[model samples]
Target: MEISVFSIQKSKADNFENEIKEYIKMSSKFAKISDLTIFNEKIAKAQSAGSESALKSYDDIYEPNLKGFCIALDEKGEKLDSIQFAKILESNSQISFFIGGAYGLSQNFKQKVDKIISLSPLTMAHKIAKLVLFEQIFRALCINANHPYHK
Candidate 1:
């Protein structure tokens, strides 16, 4: 199975990139995984403008490569523990996870996604969300492989 993460915006912090790399390395010890692909979109000029513009930008970039099951990161989606997430990893053939831009994913993208997963109820920055998702993917791989990292 190939797991792909399509995220908007580039990683700004060096620490965030390093952390994501660490988790990717850990996950690779068990299974085949792809690097997080950033889909760059121009940010809205006005801060007051709702996230709609960014979301639309994400939709435009995201819609084409969306094959297989697309999972959107959402606050209201089903919350899965590490074990359950492992099951999802084990069951699916090709899974693509989307981390929206500053504004979050558009309703159109959300509507097309196969599943919506919430990492946490509290709003997290895009960079942090990528790190968290990477760590969770590593944790899930450990669980599936019966590795000590999970316990």
Candidate 2:
């Protein structure tokens, strides 16, 4: 499987950056990572852009290359266990995840995705959201492989 993360922004904190990098490195063991595209959150929010419009702009940018299953990460989305998410990873050869900006994902984008899931019930900074998503993905891969990392 090939997993791709389309994130709104990169983490500026050094520690968070390092952790994300480590998770990315660890994830290579599970699936082929095609791309980790980070769009500038500031640019995404610029010039009177609402969440809906900004998200649509991104949809245009990444939607074409996207194939197979797609998922959106949002606060209001479903909460899945590692086992369940592992099934999703196993089923799709090309899976793409849409991570929102600081303001979060738009309603239109939420509705357009094949599935929607939430990392946590509490609101988080978008950068942290990216980290959590990456970790969960790694955990899911571990679970699928019967590896010890899931625990």
Best by TM-score: 1
* Candidate 1 per-residue C-alpha lDDT over 67-137 given as tens digits, one digit per residue, 9 for 90 to 100: 77788998888999899899988888788899887778778889999999999999887777888998999
Candidate 2, residue 9: CA error in Å? Answer: 1.4
**Positional deviation of 80 in candidate 2, in angstroms?**
1.0
lDDT of 2 at 38: 61
The residue-by-residue lDDT of candidate 2 on 1-151, one tens digit each, is 7888887564455527778778878889888764365666544564147755666666665566456788988888899888888899988888999877655666766677799998889988777787788888888888888899877
Tell me the deviation in Å of residue 104 in model 2. 2.0
Clashes of each: 0, 0
Residue 49 alpha-carbon offset, candidate 2, angstroms: 4.5
